[model samples]
Target: MADFLGSVWWMIVSLGVLVTFHEFGHFWVARRCGVKVLRFSVGFGRPLWTRRDRHGTEFVVALLPLGGYVRMLDEREGNVHPAERAHAFNNKPVWQRIAIVAAGPVANVILCLALLWAMFMVGRADYSATLGPVQGMAASANLHPGDRITDVDGRPVQSWAEASIALTLAAMDRRDARVDVLGPEGDDRHATLPLGQLPAGFAEQRVPELAGLSWGFQQRQAIVAEVSTGSPADGVLMPGDRILAVDGQSVDSADQVEPLIAALGRRGGPGMVEVQREEDRLALELTPRQDASAPGGWRVGVAMSAGTAPAYDVRAQYGPLAAVPAAIREAGRMTADTLGMMKRLVTGNASLKNVSGPVGIARAANASAKRGVDWFLYFLAALSLGLAILNFLPIPILDGGHLLYYLIELVKGSPLSDRVMIAGQYVGLALLAGLMGLAFYNDILGQLPR
Candidate 1:
């Protein structure tokens, strides 16, 4: 329930901030272009709070929080007084109209950059881009376990998050990349990975795993997380107890305890199980039970630690002035990646599953928020970039669509006929509806058990 509430709260916060900033760009530009602002609203539906400025523009914070819009006095939308005709949005010069229409996406891009700057200054904590197991493509490329990736295609990377994006993009483009790594023996090695050779159904696998890479062999302490009721382990072992050994054999990780306990069950004798229980370490006599349902044909009836995201092994922080270049570079990289993803979609090289809806956004927002402010800012930056790119696609009823109209008007010295414009709006609505439907479908599929 807390998670659900957190997801809801963060989703609202994320959307509200993005939407308000986007609309403000249009409002600010429109007003500068001499258009009469009517209502400036964040969200839709019933207004929660509203104030009218001296200029009669009503500013509102509404209930929905999903999206917002800036309404301007336009001759086409409503009858404008003849005295106010010069202030109508439709009366603006073609270039001014283009600027006003383009401002929304431009604002989001700025916001992306700003968020990234803040993230870098605050420092992003993450695990190293180290390989645990290597096979298939990674193996063919001569990569090995414990090899720490440092550079890909000339770009240096410090974390799995950055390396994964670079690698995923390479795979999508079917391009081979020169990779630099620090091997297990502390030797520097370089290899060309055949990212192009990934199978067509690679989308079904996590990018790293699809490319035959594991973050690292994460070792989990053999602390019992749960014990089944009325089972042998229920009384013999309790949650939070760390198993030290089974049948007199030492076991340190959760993965190591299973085999030893199963061996004891097969031997048909009681064994001394050593466990660390808070302040005490003791040997207790216990016998494992045979159960077909258990792995290895024996049962301990206790769940071990399943592992978790590793704590930050490194920090990517810099001074405010120093973060400028890094932030700009990140912004440029994000833009390129977003564009690349769209190209993959158009070329059918990517699955519709890659497209996510609000459900996915909510999950990401909640998860990032839990990580810390820096991580959340990073997430917001990426989401902002995506929003900017999406709004700039040359489709009708969007900012880019509006800019398209103005560009045609500029070339022909006349506006498109109302009939033609209406038809375009209809086409745009259909296209948007279909796109949104696909996103929702993907979101639902993601929730279903794999």
Candidate 2:
């Protein structure tokens, strides 16, 4: 219940702020263009809170927080006073109208960039591109655990994020990812990771996992971290005990210990465990316990003392002069990635599960909030970029649709017929409803236990 409420709160706050900013963009631009802004509202449906500004513009917060609008004085919509007819939205020049319509999404993009810039200045914790264990083809390719990935092709990667980006970019051509690494034994080597046959949207998903690398930055030692009371490890093991072997099988990493314990539990037998405690090698017999969550699952109820990953600073701590261009580039990259994903979705190459609705976004907000303020802001920045990208899609009933109409006007020297525009609106509404329905379906399905 607490988790549910927290998610709801964060979702409301996030959506409210974003929607207001978006509506404000239109409002500000319209006012500047000599258009009379009648009502500036955040959200749809009945107004929850409202106030009339001295300029006679009404400000409102409505019940439905899904979207917002800026109602302007338009001669076509209503009978405008003769004195204020010049200030009507319909009376404005086509360029001014375009600017007003375009400003909302542009503001979202600017906000996204600003958030990113702030996040960079504040800095966030990150880990180096170090590997733990190689498996299957990764081992065959001579990629070893404990090797630090220094570069992909010629591009240097100081952190995992950079490394993932580099690898994904390399995989774009459906070829191999050329990676340079420095081994634990002070040896330099290069490896080409095969990328062909990877699933669609692999760059956004699989590349980060490194495709069967089964690796971690810091090698996990076979030392016990903690033991849950009333469980198998409670009476048998203590923290700081270095696990040496299970049933005469030598254990190296912590990764090798669990499977042996699980097997013994499933077989319903005791296993001989050897551990080094304070320079003493002791042998003990222990039986694994059945996990309540999974009927057939086995557990020793001991947490592994996994060491912290090697650290790297991924933030761009740039000056004001440099931050703008950097932010712009970052925003542009996000835009391109979104468009790419959309293209893949249209081509049926990407999964619809990737489409997150309100539930997923709320969950994300709650998760990021737990991480820290910087992480929460980072999440918002990404969402903001998504908003900008989605709104700018050339679909009817969107800012892009208005822009398209303006372009048509520019070419053919007249506005699209109102009858045609109204028909387009109905079609656009249906399309949007279908898309939202899919998003909601995915969100609900995702929340359910698999």
Give the winner by TM-score: 1
lDDT of 2 by residue, 192-213 (tens): 7886556656544566455556
> Where is model 1 more than 4 Å wrong at Cα?
175-177, 221-309
Locate the minimum summed-lDDT window of 10 residues in model 2.
307-316
Residue 325 deviation, candidate 2, in Å? 4.2
Which residue segments of model 2 deviate by more than 4 Å? 150-158, 161-175, 185-188, 198-210, 217-221, 225-238, 242-253, 258-325
Tens-place lDDT per residue, model 1, 310-385, is: 6778798999999999999989988887887888888987777788898889999999999999999999999888
- Per-candidate Cα RMSD to the true structure, in Å, reads 4.6, 5.3
- Local distance difference test, each candidate: 0.87, 0.80
On a 0 to 1 TM-score scale, where does candidate 2 land against the true structure? 0.81
